[model samples]
Target chain A: MHPAPSVIIFTSFSGLGFGLLLFLGLGFPPVTGWVAFVFYAIAYALAVGGLLASAFHLGNPQRALKAFTQWKTSWLSREAWLSVMALLVMAVYAFCAVFLDTRLTVIGWIGAALSLLTVYSTSMIYGQLKTVPRWNQPLTPVHLLTLSIAGGALLAGQMTVAAALLALAAAVQVAHWQVGDGALKASGTNLATATGLGTPGSIRAFEPPHTGTNYLLKEFVHVVGRKHSRKLRMIALTLGYGLPVVLLIIPGAGHVLGLLAVISHVAGLVTSRWLFFAEAEHVVGLYYGKRSA
Target chain B: MTELPASTQKKLGLVIDLDTCVGCHACVISCKGWNTENYGAPLSDMDAYGADPSGTFLNRVHSYEITPAEGPAQLVHFPKSCLHCEDAPCVTVCPTGASYKRQEDGIVLVNESACIGCGLCAWACPYGARELDALEGVMKKCTLCVDRIYNENLPEEDRQPACVRTCPAGARHFGDLGDPDSDVSRLVAERGGMDLMPEQGTKPVNKYLPPRPKQDVSHDMDILAPFLEPVAEDPKGFLGWLDKALEKL
Candidate 1:
């Protein structure tokens, strides 16, 4: 399966959209929508950034708008349209709330609902993909929602329990990775089939089609350093997941620790996701002989 | 969103038996034939008979040799097509409303006019059902012969798919699988049918009943068994006398 940066963007970007709106809806002292404008600016910037990132994936980006028509069923359509709408709402709410009044409860609540809905929609998009069992769970929504909220709160410099939750989440994510890793290991170290090419087997090798890796091998198919794989997995699981959770409970460590936690979480997740991609042997790879027999 | 009609409708599907498929690629040829002529564009080849000849196709068959549990390892020709899943990943992954599942017949359709050619649906699908048509500059896939299936011009039975009608082996079948009483459904039920990739949870209406062998086989090659060395080559000279004694006994 193609590693959708949209799924990544949807999770990462929508956090800003939803996080800003959630605080506004809660009647927390109204920050000037100008400040909320920062959230909106970053939110939509990432939204557009995500859109552009996705644009790189297609053969043609000029024709991307034709996708907006089928929101009746397509989650991608919903995510795209709603994200744009969320940005518009954020902009509109910014202009009205900041320039006019921040006390407009109805508008804030509506904005909040839309933002959270956007995040939820983003989560559900990947969550519904049962083919990738790793991403197919309610935890995907919960994880992404928390991450976005954590991200926005961090960006907004709010060192509340959101940071604490981010820490716990980072911790849990490590554990989650291990659980998935173990499952994959038992199933021969991949989301698909087959484990590794070590010494001997009932089956043997074929000469590779390319001496240098091809595009599919480079982009879609990849293998990482196996020498220290077990150790790295442990490190990723521990420091990647554990360090952040413990940081949350530490007093006077909320903001900086939250920032560190978010950074670490992203870093760990990047590696973890990379591993996820690397570990997943595409059934196509079997035919190409790119994957080990 | 317009509310879908609640009237009784059928999710028509095709179940092509692998035991019978010859991997002739007739279905692929016919699918391209129909989509290109009817749809906006034909499947294009980047370099036909050249260094590369990549093109879009809604259906492609893969040949595999599967060793059945109780039979000889035989070549099982599998035709890969859109399962036309109830929860189509291609439909959900579309950023535009171009990819959609029909409420009436549960047909998964791609609206070319609305598609921006983002190719998100391509990534979302584990089955690689949909393909980008280079000539049309849009995504295309099997329509289940939607155009001909419902056409009033053709005879009642002639309206079905060209592939199904043309299949010389009678391996391909097209009917409403959603209705439990339909012929397709009955065939599936009696034969213990299965989805190609049920783990995806797309809930594809199309089914594939694993081939039942016409005969059985049982044997284990003992390649690892201990070898019997010639006693004459052995250094035990007493062994010759012992062998002679044992032979006489």
Candidate 2:
């Protein structure tokens, strides 16, 4: 996996943004007028900005509109459709709250569900990749969903709920890493099976196809050092999950402390998201003799 | 549109013989040459003659060393391209419906015009078969030379994949594998051909014929021992007098 900057930003920021929208749609912090406008503005910026960032990684962003057509079989297509629907519904819901000063509970509920579903769809884009064994697990969706809801709660200023959700997010994140560590080996794809040469005593890649690099090697054969990933994991856990929970639960914690918690959490989310791609071992790497997967 | 047809009329794919491939990479070069000129995209290269050169290649040959349980190590040349799987994951993962498997011939292809170049299809494939053209920003893959294979413009003998046509070793065979009576299918049956990564359950149409077991010749060294047996023992008769004089001196 490349750990592409555009994708890291997209996943992290968009997850947080949609998480906020989900909370607002559910009427958490129930503020109307300019206050509601500020919330909606921030939410849309994160969600839309993340999506735009995703487009940056595409080889042909011009044809991205066509991406909406294949939802029946493609999770990426489902994500595009779900994100659009979620954002559109949330916009209407936000407009009513900001201008009409009305709380349409049904519409708000629908928007909240759509927002959540949008995040789930995004997770599925990576989760459904059986080629990347580390991501092909039920925990992938669980990790992303928990992070979004927890981040949303924090943004909505629901300290008590945020604290609980953050704790749950931490658990899921740790479990995800635990399982992902051995996923490639567990998948049973290696040089032997990859080349159909297992009948021999043992097999090892002697030479690659070319002396020069190729798209597959560049994109799928990323090698993140163990020490670096371990350090990033610590930073991600401490700032993204641990610190937020502590800050939210601390007695007499005020606005300044809340702002610090949000900043810390966002920073942590970005780090963890980087690891998400960097650590993913695509099975295709076996052909290149890069890794076991 | 990304949904695969219930069944393809023919499972058209390659059967590569690992035993015969000399790892010369002739098919790889031929594939690149033909595809860049004939296919939808030119298979562009970045920094081609400079440092960090990279390019999109539909077919590639990788070499591997395998040690048998009882014999010496053997090198096998593995050429990989799109398997054109019965359950092609790349097709189903395309968000733009640009990637599809033909219901007629079972050739998986990317409609480059419709491609967003999101690269999800590349990620979905386990074989690393599909590559995104850096310059064109569209997916490039082995169409199995769809143009050449079906082109009425070419001579009947030339109407096959560029790699198949160019293979000097006769290692690459192309035909309908779905037809049990096809030449390729018969070759597969005789050679005990196998699929790559069957556990992934992609149900690949392509098959690989494993290298036959090697013969051990270490014990045959005894035949050469007689030639080295005292051919100059005690020197020649003329040199014997010189040896005696040297000993006296």
Candidate 3:
């Protein structure tokens, strides 16, 4: 609920796009010039997609420029400003690469920061929203940060360090997700306990206060209501994570591991993000007479 | 060159005594009265008096009967609207300049002209404070009667928010929350006030003092006896069929 696909795509693509550019510029070069150019274009698409999607969430997309004025206090405004700054950095880097030269020392720092900020701000957007307690925690930002590094690592050429970082991030992510799931369960238990109920069982009720479904229920309590999809979710995580590991080290992917790495990470992340939003319980859900699961 | 314009200063807000609010919704009606005429557009009722009655209101008084297992039913009337937080999240979340927290006095106002009618602020609010005015296609909320509070034509004391002015029980109070020594601040301090949803961390300036009036159930022993009946029997109204069907079959 805290994140939309625009945000998801922005963080992931920006990471890959900027990450590839930075890695090639810093560690390896000449050969990855082609990769860098392609990634810059990919990064641009993702960033613009994110910006457009974010605009829809705004009351006035045309007046979004005003967000730059409040960068001192608001994280969202800072995000808007930083995103624009990132685009400029990217454009300049591209220009210099073609004619003059993309300075590894100067533009590298900018690209790195752009990737970091793109992911960081995207994380902070949800991290700051206090209403959704699930997202308000620091783990939200940490998860996004790790995700950036993971995306960057997947784009690595030969260094085992990249794979190591990816593995470390995956571990942290799994641990954090476990903690989050525990927190969610604990809160549900606490709510049920507070109402003098023992283990929430079949607490469904009718009589929604509003006639038409409001945005809250639709977005937050978006239970699929189908048993089959739940099974699909389990498989998504398994295949997403499992296949990538197998493809990376099995020595069969040849030079194609890079592409597979990108696909697997994105697929796994999409599944995780979907579960993250789907599993969260809104306090208002209780008012509609929802029993704790 | 230094410029200083002479403008009358009035800190606008509402103070509801949780003890006295009878849940009759009189303030809600009066609020509807004032905003209907003064606001850019009226709060629309989707289906008035129908099966599905839902609409927008500047104020709504909710009656919650808080019953203590040891005692009787204590009806707590909560009239909720915009609390006008000192650090308003709704204003901050707005991607457009439509939502603004006025520096003049910390009143969170949404400019209808500039608003694109995005509901981000509504989600940001844990208290469900802001509502999108479907008729105007813009965000609308309790303005604290800003138009009337400084109308100048009305008497000095009469120029107050409709919620404060029309509260029959004198439960609602309006004053400057910024001033530490203001009446509203003092009332909050003296009454040990709490907020509607404090865990939200929005730091809402508006405070609701505790109203734990004990209700006596001693006189209604006969009526209350049924409440203690076995809850497992037929909460869903299916126990009768199972009991009768067994004998018939």
Candidate 4:
């Protein structure tokens, strides 16, 4: 809920990168030689860069290797394992596609599925948190996957396909906001419920636990104004979805237009991702008598 | 390793009485003092004694004002720490297997050596129990004072969490709640101890006793009328009689 910078960068770029890898693994754009090399390079850079950005947020980056071992329970662990598998598979597939100029259908298909699965695992890392009611929903994964695929399709230069996926992603984003905005209110948690003091009447915090900010306040009790959030959402809708859709779908929309669409979509997505964390209301805030929903 | 056991052998936890806590913060200070040295990493402080001071603390006391529709408002002091839940999401969400719930006593702990400090366990906890040590880059939380509780170094009577031992009001109790005959279990039954935010379904081991019902102490006029009798004047005069009458009133 902190809207941490490293996390925002990691989620945004990695989703797009993986989305592109999925398309490439499935043999989209049908290119070979230098053109294919450039695509693979961009995908790998984005994907790897995003992974490094994630590691940067860790307090002990050296210990991150241990994260791969807890896949049986932790979604973050699953994400680590899945992303590694997806990246490895994509690397081999890229080798065959660029060097041999022939896509191995089985390997290609496997890589594509793994790529998508990796993205899903990333989404699950947030979605599994019951403390943050805004993210604990089926729509979280839907939003992540749709946005990744749409962004991927755009970067892969598949204008027609990207347009349709962008539209779908936009719809999912809208629905996600519609549902997530009300999730905290729907959850039956309040200060009384949080403290197990359900009798008497409404509860209000008389004295905070500490005078200065603590880890909980910094990490879980973020507050974003409704007016600002509303304005950001409108900007996100216009740039992330609207402009990209109009630009990509217009007749005679050349490479310049496609690139512009990609830029606008990425910008819009950044805003959306910021909202994704800022708007999330952790249930722990109820203990402070903050908004429950 | 991150998965919780089917059941813990004993549910060792704290039972806090909200009715008696005086918000003295003795437990908070004692916990910080004992844990900062006892634990592997010190509970680091940033900008301490400055304009804005903050430090990692295992236990914290929060006060709340509860106003009933029919009566006056009451202030309640709440001391919070890890509940060591049976189905702890914090343990399950640990990516590096650093966070775990002890099978022997159901006491949740963090293996500091393995913690990557991604802070997921903190995010998963509803009580805001875990705090990331910014200096050490690791997550730390209340271990229920496993070191002190199991230590043979001190007197047997002192085998409890620093917070519980330091509580001045006797508001804190620690014991195995698994046994129905235990003192804690009886207290919970008698005092109607409750789980905080049960809907989260963590099945917390610790419990909180709600504040006692308030009583009205206003005197009725009719009951006091007979007691307000005026004294008769003696040779001293009206002043003496007036003093006696005022005292009676």
Candidate 5:
């Protein structure tokens, strides 16, 4: 897992953006006119900007339109379709709320559901990868969904709901790390199984295929130091979940505190998202003798 | 279109013999040479002669040392490429339907023209078989030399994968594994050819023949002791007289 910057930005911002859209679509803030316009603008910027950031990682961004065609099997395709639909539906809903001062309950509800589904689709893109054992778990979707909804509640200024959701997000994130820590070992894909050489007493990498690095090694064989990752986990938890919950729950917390909470949460989200890719041990790394699958 | 067919008509793949591979990497070079020239995209290299050289290669050979329970350590040269699995994850994970397994021959291939180069297919593969061409920005993989295998232009003997044709050790075998009676299938049956990472449940068509047990050659040194014995304990005739004369002198 390369912990690619484009993907980290894409996942973190898009999750937050869609989460906010989900709240706005359901009339959480219930604001009208320019206030509603500001909310919609932020949501569109985050969501659309995140999607565009994802395109930056693609080697051939020009052919990305073709990515929409394989939703029948591919989660990435499902994500493209879902994100577009969510954005389009939210646009219409936002227009009505901001300009027409009308609340169409059915359209808003549909948009909210689509927005949530878009985040889930994005999560599934990683969750479905059996090659990366850390992400191939029910907890993966649970973590992403909780984070998105919690972030959405925070942006909507629903302090009580945001507090509770942030607490829940913290719990899910911890549980995800707890399980993901041992996922590759639990996968039972060691060097022996990887090479089908188990009959021997033990197998060790005698020599590598090439002296220079290749795509597989560069992409999948990332090695994050244990001590460094531990420190990062603490930082992510304190900023992403702990601080936000505390800020939202404080008795006299005002606009400034709320803004600080949002900033802290975003910073935390980016850090954790970086860890998400960096810590994932892809089974393919076993072939390179870089790690135990 | 990313959905796999119910079953391919033929499971055409390679059966590699781990016992015979000498770790020469000949197949690797031959595969690169043939594929770059013949395949959809020339497998491009970035900073080929410079500091950080990296490139896309469909086939690669890795060497490993295995210590048997009772005997000495053995080195095995493992050559890996696309397994062309019956349940190929790379095919189903493709967002653009560019990656697909042939319903006719079971050869998994990327339609490079349609490829978005998102690289999800590469991530989905546990074998690290597919590589994205840095220059072309399209995925490259082993087509089992689809062009050469089926080409009417090549000689009948040359109608096989470039790696298979170029392997000097006769370690690489190619045929339909779907047919139980095929030479490859029979070889698999006799040698107990095993799939790599069977628990992944990809149901790989390719098989690997495990190296045969080795003999400990330490005891063979005793047989050469007879050659080191003196030809005669006592010299005869002139040689015996010369020996006594030299002793007197």
Candidate 6:
């Protein structure tokens, strides 16, 4: 719930990168020469840059290589392994498409599948957290997948596909927020249940453990005002999904509109991701008597 | 390695009595003082002496005011730490196998050497048991005083968690919860000890003894009339006059 900058960048940018790679691998909006090179550049930069940015969130970034070994049980490990596999497969696919002037459909399909799988694993990293009720739900993966696909479509200049996916993504995002708000409110635990004092009429925090902040408070106890959150949600909804939908509908073939849509969507997603982290209510907050999270 | 064993050899944990805890924070301080120099990294503080101080600790005590429907309000001191759950998500979620639950005893611990400190284990826990050391950039948590518990150098009586050993009110108990015959388990059985947030499905090893019902104090005593006869009718001496003047002032 700390909403560290590195993680936000990693999740959003890498999702867009993989989404674009998925389209390229499927040979959508087929292009070659300088155009292909530029597409590949954006895809590689986003995918690789996002991967590198993820390491910065770790306490010891140098030891990140160890993370690849525990894919059997850890979603973070799965994400690491899958992202690497996708990137490597995409590299081969890119070489065939750009240099050999051949699109090996089989390898391209494999690369595309892997790329999407990588995004799913990233979403699962947060989605699997049962401690944070707001995130541990079916909607989390839905939101992640739809947003990535929409962003990827826009980046690849597939206007009609982008417009449709953008609408779908916006709907999913709205649905996710609606469900999330209710889920947090309806969490089973409360101050009484948390402390096993349910027989008492009411439980109130008479005194905090300490006057000063501690690690748990700093990392998990983020409190955002409802008014402020509502305002930000409006801003995110407008910038992230609405503007892209509007730009693509203007009936223009200019590259500028497509680029603007991508930028606007990415910016909107940043705000959404921030809200995602900020609004998440960890169950541990119950120990401190935080009513909602 | 992060997968919990099918069954631990012994379920060693603490059972804290809520009624007797007294909210003194002695266990919290003792845990911090001993653990800071023992098995793991020192509990570090950021801006310790500044206007806003923050730090890491293995144990914390939360005080709550409980108002019952039929009685006066009472303050309950609730101390919390790692419950060493039977189905610990913290261990399974660890990407580097740094976080693990011991098979010999059901003690969840972190291997500092292997920890990348990504903090997924902390996120997996519902009890707020784990914390990250700001200075070392590694996760630190209650080892159940593993070093002290197993150390032969310590006196036989002192071979327990520092919190349990130092609690002035004897509210903290550490022993084998798996053995029904153990003092802690027997105490739990006697006191009707209960788990915290059983719905989370962690199946915590630790238990809490609930507070006893309050006595009806009002029924035992008579409402006597005024005992003192009005302070000798406002001053037989200079001292009395001064007392009345001070009260008025």
Tell me each candidate's i-RMS in Å: 6.9, 0.9, 7.0, 0.9, 0.8, 1.0
Q: What's the CA RMSD for each of the models?
A: 8.8, 1.5, 9.4, 3.5, 2.6, 3.5
Q: Best candidate per DockQ, number?
A: 2
Q: Candidate 6, residues A175-246: lDDT per residue as tens digits?
A: 999998877656676667789884424777788898988878878988889999999999899999999899
- Structural similarity of chain A in candidate 2, as TM-score: 0.98
- Estimated TM-score for each candidate: 0.69, 0.98, 0.76, 0.95, 0.96, 0.94
- Fraction of native Cα contacts kept in each candidate? 0.28, 0.90, 0.21, 0.83, 0.85, 0.75
User: Looking at the true structure's interface, with contacts defined as alpha carbon pairs within 8 Å between chains A and B, what fraction does model 4 recover?
Assistant: 0.83
Docking class of 5: high
| lDDT of model 3 at position A207 | 37
- Candidate 4 wrong stretches, greater than 4 Å: A199-201, B219-249
Q: Where does candidate 6 clash, by residue pair?
A: none
Q: Write the per-residue lDDT of candidate 5 for residues B92-207, one digit (tens) a residue.
A: 99999999999999999999999988899999999999998889889999999999998999899999999999999999999999999999999999999999999788999999
User: Which of the two candidates, 5 or 6, achieves a greater TM-score against the reference?
Assistant: 5
Clashing pairs in 1: A67-B96, A67-B97, A68-B96, A69-B97, A70-B97
Runs in model 2 with CA error above 4 Å? A199-201, B228-230, B234-236, B242-249
* Candidate 1 lDDT, A1-293, residue by residue in tens: 44456534434444554665565544453666576555556556655665566565555567777656667766766877777776666666667766765556676677667777777777777666544455554566776666566555555555555556567666555555555444422323221221111112322223332233323333335455576556666665555555665665577875577778667655654554445445544433443434443
Docking class of 3: incorrect
Q: Which candidate should be chosen as best, given lDDT against the real structure?
A: 5
Residue lDDT tens for model 4, A1-293:
79998999999999999999999988897767778899999999999999999988899999999998899999999999989999999888888878988778788789899999999999998999888889998999999999999999999998999999999999999999999988876766667678976442567888998889988988888899999999999999999999999998799999999989989999999999999999999988877666634
lDDT tens per residue, model 2, A208-269: 88898888988999999999999999999999999989888899889998999999999999
Q: Which tens-of-lDDT digit does each residue in B14-59 have in candidate 1? A: 9777668776777777777876677556767656677644666677
How well does candidate 4 match the true structure, expressed as C-alpha RMSD? 3.5
- Of the two candidates 2 and 5, the one with more favorable TM-score, higher being better, is 2
- Looking at model 2 chain B, report the run of 10 residues with the lowest lDDT sum: B230-239
* Candidate 4 chain B minimal-lDDT segment of 10 residues: B213-222
On DockQ, the stronger of 2 and 6 is 2
